[model samples]
Target: MIASSARLARAAGGSRNWLLGVLRGSSYGTASEASFQVESYKLHKLEQGPSTSVTLSRDDGLKMYRQMQTVRRMETMAGNLYKSKIIRGFCHLYSGQEAVCVGMENAMTPDDSVITAYRAHGWTFMRGVSVQGVLSELTGRVSGCAKGKGGSMHMYGHNFYGGNGIVGAQVPLGAGIAFASKYRGEEAICVTLYGDGAANQGQLYETFNMAKLWNLPCIFVCENNGYGMGTSVDRASASTAYYTRGDYVPGLWIDGMDVLAMREGTRFAKDYALKNGPILIEAVTYRYSGHSMSDPGTSYRPRSEIQEVREKRDPITNFRERLLSSGLATEEELKKIDTEVRKEVETAAEKAKTDQELPLEELYNNIYVDPPQGMKIRGCDPTIMASTR
Candidate 1:
């Protein structure tokens, strides 16, 4: 390039020619550097951790961007479905927390298991459950992961424990799973997730002690999504450092909005837990929607807060920017991905609408492994009890 510039300068008789040479060589783009050049994007509010190397190659960047977009689109559709009365019971949309689930899932191996509390739509999708099944579950259709039984709070998959409803209840169950994995001499690590609200529960600390004592391979993920239901973390908890909530257990705090960072943090935690027992991850993230369908998300928090996060820290947008900056993809390509994801989610919803709801007998059968002669439980309607005689 320099030699060519010199020859052009001589041919054009000086500075005017040199300027032309430079202008011709440089492409008009946001970044002056080569499109494929890797750039450093800083992690936000990472309070603590031993850092891990992240190579956001073109394939990885685009893939993660696509996954996060899918989760966001899925949650948006779920919210719409809920407002339309298609999704009944309690429904918690995991819109802004897409990075946490997608990153964690990416870091997980086939043997690694996962269990989280109610906000579990994204996790269920990542665990090999089809989008159709997830939507069907939300729509209370039999095609759901649990055949319409679990709904949003109880979908299950291979090596995935559940969408447990009770607060902090899944923690010990996760420990039990890790223990079982150890007993079988399997190298599986269990990732147990709960919210900041559940962080204050005594059961979590109890499980932490047992897990540390037994040296179980467990990654206790505290998804600190700013609020515990209607109350902010500061309003609810005495201390907000969820990572350190498990006293003796080592903890790492990461910017949960960054998918690459989340993936690296989870990977480290999983590896550390396998040999050194339990570790905790306080993934600082935010949720775009209300705690559930019952709560209007804007009451406790200002709408501006959500808007700011959406504009500035949106995981999907941030990842997309990285891809564009690195020349991994053009703006058109990313938009195309978004367009495809939105359509895919919409199609799943359409298909889910046609699924058959579980019959009333299903209520009585799943409750007991062996149905007694006089088994009776509340059917589809609580006012009318159905008998399994």
Candidate 2:
């Protein structure tokens, strides 16, 4: 009877009745039949294979989930600190876009380098900089990754080049790193990340041409978070498809909020670049905080929009759900991780607040490896000679 009804509905121009009946039968019908239908759907999707979910192992999923959670909590702590005026200077938080860094870092080896714009706390954390080091940097203390000189916008770790201040300037630097890696005959690749706002910079194209001309092993990533500072990507660039900005580089666009998809896409890009030269990946992610903690974050965008993204598509929440559904992790386990991460962030912030600021004289210390001849020495300048002239 159900088959006859489905046939009649299909005969009627593939109407809604056919779709509804199919769904009903699949859900409320025989278990065996439902299983068969699911298998058929999976096979069909595999054959089509345009947009599909990327498979992830339980260990990979859990690791990505933990990294993302750590970033989320760390950003949340920074926002609170900024509110209290504990952390000052241009601070860009990467709260809503954890998966991009976590996934890409997972695809990279320890020797591979990464450089990004001011929105870099996430990358720093993923690159093995302790939360304490990042918080200390924000607080301008001696314990920071840059020893308090490079504040929130310039933290670095071993192999992680920088949190560059110039908008799209890191592209060429990343290319340079890649050039060095290739010169040394190393298999390492450099991943340079930039914002949608920086995508319009003419230098990016120059770097792209050079990278391609030399067949450099570099992965140029554009984190298309919709807005660059106060300007939406649409307003800033005629061509908003940032991945395609590098016309010479093959491009891949992944759902940035989906950890599995990000991991799979980044892995594919890294491998392809290793073999076929450079590649570009555009991860469509979002940032929840203001471009920095100073901006109210509502002047250019709607609160409703941020709320929608958070409630519906939060990367951490999405990954948590997938893990639970797949039995890779339990809700209790995830909650414990969340609690521990929050506590760790809070402790780091407290330590950062009390850590001593860099000495005023240290400012002139690292200016040069050795002082230039006849260079005017300033107060406490380490360049001052100890000899009696």
| CA lDDT for candidate 2 | 0.75
Q: How would you encode candidate 2's per-residue C-alpha lDDT over 1-389 as one tens digit per residue?
A: 23211211111111111211121122111211110010001111012211233445555666778889889888888888888898887889998899889978887889899999999999998999999999999889888888888988898998999899998999999999999999999998999999998898999999999999998999898898989889998788898777677886677776677565576677777777787788887888899878877678899999999997887677787566545544455677778878888889889998899999988877766655556665655553533543211
Q: TM-score of model 2 relative to the true fold? A: 0.84
State TM-scores per candidate. Answer: 0.83, 0.84
The candidate that wins on TM-score is 2
lDDT of 1 by residue, 1-389 (tens): 21111111111111111111111122222222222211122222334454544554456667778888888888889899989998899999999899899888888887889999999999999888988889999998988888888899999999988899999999999999999999999988999999998888999989999998999999999999999888899999888877777878888877787787788778777878887888888888899889999988999999998998887777787666555544555788788898999899999999788878988666654655554555555542332334334
Clash counts for the predictions, in order: 0, 0
Against the reference, the lDDT scores of all candidates come to 0.78, 0.75
